[model samples]
Target: MNFFHGQETLSVIEWILRSVVTFFFLLFAVKVMGSRAISQLRLLDFVMALMLGNIIAHPLSDHRIGLKGSVISTIVIIILYLFGIFLNLKWTWLRNTIETMPIPLIKEGDIIYKGLKKARISIDLLLAELRKEKIADVKKVALAMWESDGKISIFLDPQYEAITPSTYQLETELFDLPRTIIKEGKIDFQALKQINKEEGWLVNELKNHHQTELNRVLLATVDYKHNLNVFLY
Candidate 1:
């Protein structure tokens, strides 16, 4: 029993050591490869990562890299890499779709309430992220966008006179009535009235904005100059 326990303990220690080595190796490779592998995430980068993992996984394991496994793995990685390249070239939308859009954490001097809700993030969390970028004041942020690969972009407001409404119109894209206006436990009556600028406006507006239940909106505001801000629970 003592001998058996000793052998088991040794096995566990060996496993732990192997895991540590594998982790460090991968970490080193990632560091050498740079941030683009995660940020841009091109087909080449993805395939290289998979191949790198497989290459490292083999040496760590008890099994040797046979001629067949080596050739097959290489071919599979190559095929995947080629396919990704083809997709990127053939379909621009495919690449665009795969890449995440900049999420609006804040819009037009207001912390986009609905955006945070959609992202399942909290105000404090968003503030913490902004603080990392040396941004303490929410008012200072004109456009705080969450980037493609888990990056936050804080666009500070330019120190200039506000442009004319005509300039605003030129700069903005005219959109129809908002779909989901009231969000994140807040009211957007102004937004409701704006769209339903007629009789029974409140009821119709509420219906359009899907405010059948008043308690649903966590935050709601509208800046027709840009986009409707909403946050729902």
Candidate 2:
């Protein structure tokens, strides 16, 4: 009985050790891989990570390289990922620290070469990219940002700031949002409530516009100018 109990305790201890080591190793590997490993990751990066995980998981899980050990390691990795996601949602600072922040690559129309270099972006390539967008002059750019997700966002200098207002034509109307009255062949009752409108209002408007049936209408929306635009067929 004594020998049996000792064996049981040792088994439990071994499992605990395996779990702890596997968790830490996976965590470190993911972090060291950098934000780009997951964000804007290429096909090769994803494949390599998957292959490495499969190979490394075995020894970490059961102290042996086998299918069962690989399964255990995969489970550990999933748990770690879930835990990290939870913490990221709960802690803003942690999320910010782990994730990349948008860096200002251009400030006051001046390119910050150091920032671009740190991001592994070439100044000549960036300038060429801007030119493709019809932005020929860097002096006309108010701000340029290298987003965390590996996308660049360019903010052009305001019309009046970059060029005189008189040089451009003025538009009389403000940009407006389109309203949806129906979706997926079903009436969106919640949308009607939010818009402070009823089903009767939609029916009457459609009828007034000579639209016979709701099913016949593929899409009906109120444009920014408060004009109803309908599409069918």
Candidate 3:
């Protein structure tokens, strides 16, 4: 019996199985890492991709190792990483330890030099970020935070925000959040009650708008201005 006779056939089968596993598991591993890895590309995300890629390569090139061992090791690492992420999300202490919170770079028109230094953000860089947010003066910024994902969130002083209908000291009623009273030709009586409107009142109002039947109304909402918007199917 030739020593290598049947071994070649076995090697071909092994290669096919390993190829399929490696190809699919790479995608699975990335998904397990989470979507933030794609959108944010935070430090942890980059490290995971690099590490998983390295682990997958060694087994592909070396036929001496069983394909299952390498894949299993990769899965173990992913599981551990995911557990750490879950802890960071659920536990406050672990969250702070694993990922830093948004640092307050500016407060009440004063630059927090201490915070800027801690975040390793220079004055020039901070100014550049401010400019991107279209803030011309730091004095106009009521608050500015350096977000963990490497972006800046700016809250303008009430006076600095753009003029609106009520910006010029004009008296305005309190804004009430709108609620749907009708949706898809069905009356939401529960929503009407939540808005302090009686079912009979809604029917009467709908009649005023020439909408006699709830089944004919496609959409309706009562907004902060006490205005009823109704649309027919």
Candidate 4:
């Protein structure tokens, strides 16, 4: 019987061969398409991806498409995608024509109503993303932009920023990043090393906070000033 012959039941050999071919083709296609296929996916690209998946799914899941027909269709889609990628890279005009540019949502601490309407994003959603950046007051923001990926990028006014003693020529503690000491009832020895702290110091600190049992501690972190903050479970 022909390999591509209509059959109600799929043999192990047929399944294996078809799977390998489809998997490799998809892998190669994605690699060529770049991370944009998986990350920061624009709406058009997202729809195109769903269509490609539908095309490939017929042969793998349903027997509507035979191996030969599926492979050829898949190849055509991949090649067309590759040509689009080529155009995107080589032609600046084409790239701009296909992709959306960053839109300004806020300027000088004031919302640009026209821009908000053009972006098709609501004021509530914009404020939500700004709050995530630890911005309590919108007036403190100098500019807010809606990125191409639909995320907001906030720029704070210099006057509202945290004052550094050094900026005014005063003394200040050395800056450092916080390190997690414990998380989810588990001790993190690596974090202790990151803060240049010993396990004994960690144990004593835990005890000082009335948390002698590491398992009972929900979360702990060494702050920028080296102060240990413990959260109990």
The top-ranked prediction according to lDDT is 4
Candidate 1, residues 116-168, lDDT tens digits: the string is 87667788888898799787678888888876655677787875335666765
Using Cα atoms with residue i matched to residue i, what is each candidate's TM-score against the true structure?
Answer: 0.45, 0.49, 0.55, 0.62
- Model 4 stretches astray by more than 4 angstroms: 1-6, 11-21, 162-233
Clashes of each: 15, 0, 0, 0
Off by over 4 Å in 1: 1-35, 38-55, 64-71, 160-233
Per-residue lDDT of candidate 2, residues 1-233 (tens digit): 12111132335566566566557766776675556556664333445467666666545443334334454555565556556667866999987887677888898789998889887899887897688778988988889888765678888888625554456776446656787766545577876676777888778877888556788777777764446667764
lDDT by residue (78-165, candidate 3, tens digit) is 8877887777778899767666688999999999999899889999999999899888899999999987777788999988888987
Ranking by TM-score: 4, 3, 2, 1
Off by over 4 Å in 2: 1-72, 82-104, 128-134, 158-178, 193-201, 222-227
- Higher lDDT: candidate 1 or 2? 2
Model 4: which residue pairs collide? none
The candidate, 3 or 4, that scores higher on TM-score is 4
lDDT of each: 0.60, 0.67, 0.78, 0.79
lDDT (tens digit, per residue) of candidate 4 on 1-233: 33454467787897777778778888988887778778877755766688778877888876545777766776787777778878888999988888778899998989999889989999898888888999988888999988766778889999988877767898766767778889987778887787788877888887886656787888888886678888887
